[model samples]
Target chain A: MRGKDVRLEDVVMRFGSFTAVQQTNLTINAGEFFSILGPSGCGKTTILRMVSGFIDPSEGRVLIGGEQMNGIGPAKRPTALIFQNLALFPLMSNWENVAFGLEARGVAKAKRRDRAYELMALVGLQGHEEKTPNELSGGQKQRVAIARALAVEPAVLLLDEPLSALDLKLRQYMRAELKEIQRKTGVTFIFITHDQGEALTMSDRIAVMKAGVVEQVDTVDNLYAHPRTPFVATFVGENNVLEGKISHIQDGFAIVETQQGAIRGINQDKATIGDKAMVFVRPERTKLLNGAALDNTFEVDFERRDLEGAFVNLFFKSDTGSIIVHEANLGQHKELEGRAKIGFNASDAIVMRSGELSDE
Target chain B: MNSLIRSYGKGLTGIFVTLTAFWLLLLIILPQAFMLDQSLWSIDKDDQLGMKIDRAYSDLGLLEYDAQQATGDTNPAVQEKIDTLKEEIATLEAQETDPPREYGLQNYTRMSSLHFSIFVKSIFYALAVTVLAFAVCYPVAFTIAKLATPQRAALLMLGLIIPYAINELLRVYAWLMILDYQGVINSLLAWMGVVSFADKTWIPFLEYPGSVFVALIYAYVLFMIFPIYNTVETLDKNQLEAAQDLGGSVFLTHWRVVLPHAKPGIAVGCIMTFMLSVGSYSVPQIMTRGKSGDWFSQLIYRQFFETQNWNVGAAYAFSLVLVCLAFILIMMKVFKVGIRDISK
Candidate 1:
């Protein structure tokens, strides 16, 4: 089978009366490292399970490799899912565990053994055939689970926050390993995780979900730099969100009346004047200008500053609300504290309405 | 004193520990030792005890005399038995006598008799019961562990345990009712005309070939179910799904993954059920009415209580214990696991 090309059309799942996912539509291209990102109880896992055929959609259809997957159960589906817990079998030897798929496919013992050894070697676990799941470390166990998933060569591999169980350092390492493995296997990966860093670092395209709805689905750059909705803008990355009423509109740019005086910003996609709108600016995009263009400026005392090795997180409150500004150190300029007037360019500010977003 | 000399304020704890250990061992293990010792020895015909001596010594007023020095009354046992015999022996020249035989290995030779076959039978019955109970319990245990949701599973667990809260004998008796000639099963069968009272006299429902086996197994089924269920509950759901995604069918998953994952559970359940069933007397006794359901425990009980022979009964009991231990050793080796592994 070709890699997983998943298309979820208006899918809605309900348990009893509570709808976990409502009207979610998304199409992930084949071989694209896609991710569904959400907070706890936001139904990201529910979406993954729906795709994997563990939980059927109550209302919509899921298509894999252009084939409709309505009645297809998890066992019959071409998709393989790596559970959040990475459920490796504890009793079987590592080789037997990895070779389980081939064994199930009626492969002979000796052949399956060879195939299993090859898979283990691919996963950097060559001599681990006799080891059980408990005998391996966290990362090695994860790789084993991945190898087990890869053994049958499914169309699409689904991961349900599989690395969430590991420690921070291990999780980071596994993220790279997972991406590299996905690249090497060339299998479509539909990764599910609430961790923003994991999604941003590994996904080719990310689908941010909220309350069983896809808020937005796009490439990481597009999702961050040009979010169509307030939820998307805030969820994709750290951004300074400000509520504003469009005081005036002229020629494609709107002058917004915010708590921090009046500022002019261009609307992304489309938004009209006199409309209650939301504007967002990235923390790193708020440049501390050297008395240059002064379209946006904040005169405030520094509440606190966090020196984060390469950059500093500056926390200061404007008349509107507390704002966080990120600044990278070049070793040329001294750290700013106490009080200063900072200004950001107008091009970096993006004004957007709340309605033009998708729950991927 | 040793504990005190080698210890401090914490040293007193060692003293207490040693004292407790000594008492605990005496309470639990000494009886088993006594049983083992009794099984190895038997009375002789003279004393009506476990084993006998080879040489004749004394009965009432008996004496042994060596005539090389001319003696009429010199009996060693008589000397120990009575002062009158001793005085009579002293009056003789006190010639050297033939010595009585020491201990002999008569009881070990008797261990292969028909009575000893009960031990083998107990071992056989227990092993079968364990296997049968495990077969019945595996699916239920797997469902409890993997299939059910968290909240509903608590109720299912309660369902498994509620029967256990009833009297064990009552549970065994319940099967008796189900298996009896005029019982529910027989009546239902007769009503269905599968086996008719009008056509034939003996329907053979209660007297089936495997009836006692059925009753004994039914009575001890729970012992096999719970340990396995507990063990499989921790099995990762993701691993099973991962196996499924990796091109494993349900059969493949179960054979290659699920069964292997559940090994510790199966091993533990088998061990518990086999140990308990092999030594149990009530279920077979009550259900089969001591007819064809004569378990080895009953045989041992008879040896101990019926014949006033602790030595033989203890021997039988110890033999059973040894067999059980052997079964456990075989199980551990067969399962290829340590006790710690299974428990985990």
Candidate 2:
């Protein structure tokens, strides 16, 4: 009933000659909702499988509750995995699907049914005990999968994008529901997803992975505010990137010279003079300069405007790279077009040593 | 009919409907009806009818000789005798041309005790073959469908289907060679010093009913594999991992998940195997090679060819057809699959 910490100590996984996951060390705290966020084929799912005992690391050890889990199978481990498709047993009714683990452990039929119903009720599925999984909707099936895993009282719960099949509204709704369930059960939930919004919304901490490496692992707020690498910066959210070289570094900030001109920003990576660097500023931080004397300003030709529900996205173009400015939907500046001046303060812009950016 | 026309237009649809009706009436329904009719009737041929006809012909010849000796002045008694002989010949010829037809189930009821035992034994042996084949094929089907990678699965499938490219009789003969008295297994046994061909003391595996069973199983194995493989292939792999993740043992996983999903295929496989095994004439005949008791199919063959009784042969053959039909129905019921599912 209590959560257990999962630690991967120098773990490496390989299939034939291809290494799926490199030597990596991670410790997930007990009862915390942790998420591994990455694009497809980035080895996040490999880490999840290793912790679930479905696979053994080729090199190092995986420990759960401070006990080595080298050769133990998934059935013997204290973890339950909800597959990407929410692989509920379609032949069985909802209650039977939930009770299968209990039935496997030799629980009486009546007790298993009752426990299944109780777990279903915990997932807010009180009256759908006898319906088959196909008879339910996508969101309902997601709840059933969670209840089924919870019925086993696994110390750690691993979910691999169980919400990916649901529609956007349902996916958003299930995020809240899953967070509530994790909070109530106090089970260590290791959620794997490529959707940054889902990870940012529900995770206590997030590990951003790329090509078999963990680039950064931190709380959602910190990951957003202080991404350690250029990949993390561009991947987690939309950023206006300006490629340039560090012209000067002083007073916790660096001045970067670009084709548009020199811009000053916070030096997160501490770039020295004459070093290549990239300045990243959030779209929302770029404002209409109007007449204010900001530290960094640019006059850009208007590209286009996209109207979102609560915000408007304004695209501006330069010779080097395009920039986007996010403006609140105030019903003002609806017709502003052509050349415009936009600016952000030096503290708002982050300058890091040039590296690989996300494709998006 | 309307749907067919709507789907394929009138001309092609007409051909389709006609071909289908022809197939139903000519291929399936008429042949069975003919067999049933043949099985239901018998001929009333008296044992002395041929002898009486022969006696009448000899008497007519004697009368002709006597008339020739009389020369121009015919005797009334002799003429009367000739006239009587002619009438007798006409009546006997008519009777020979159209014997009286007796309609009954006598053809089926007249099976001898030995033949009846053979019938029962054939059914049981077929059942055993079906069961053994299932035991052997379920694992193979599952492994190819779910466990092996795509290329390996394809390779295994090719291996399974290669033997079928040869004629079935040839395939059964191959097994006969492997299990004969001095066949492959016996020669291997001779090499091991258990039996010797020189002393004429080799194991007589062909004399046992198990040899027939081995051939029967081998002949119909693919019938069991492909159906089960097809159904198991459609199963979502995630369901398997989910069962394992939830702590279900391997046996429980198969019992609850994989087996349930494959019910229709299992039913189809069992039906095909049982029907093929029960009605297989060449397999048992080739394997047994007259050293063992006859299978029901062999018995039916003897009734037609050796015994020269088409009626009884039809009856025995019809009984087998009924056994197969009953087996199909039983399988459909037991597996809780509909006929549509089995066909698929």
Q: How close is candidate 2 to the true structure, as a TM-score?
A: 0.96
lDDT of 2 by residue, B1-344 (tens): 79878888999998988999999999999999999999998766666888889999999999988987886657777888999999998888778788777899887888889889999999999999999999999999999999999999999999999999999988888998898878999999999999999998998888888888888888999999999999999999999998998999999999999999999999999999999999988988888878778889998998899977788899999999999999999998899999899889
The residue-level lDDT of candidate 1 at B276 comes to: 83
Taken in order, the candidates have interface RMSDs of 1.9, 0.6
lDDT tens digits, residues B110-206, model 1? Answer: 7655766766676787788888888789988888789989888789889877888898888878877887767778778888877766666434544
What is each predicted model's overall lDDT from 0 to 1? 0.77, 0.92
Q: Write the per-residue lDDT of candidate 1 for residues A6-47, one digit (tens) a residue.
A: 999989899999989989889999988999988888899998
| Cα lDDT for residue B209, candidate 2 | 88
For model 1, state the Cα shift of residue A290 in Å: 2.0
Listed in order, the DockQ scores are: 0.50, 0.82
Evaluate model 2 with DockQ and give the value. Answer: 0.82
Best by TM-score: 2
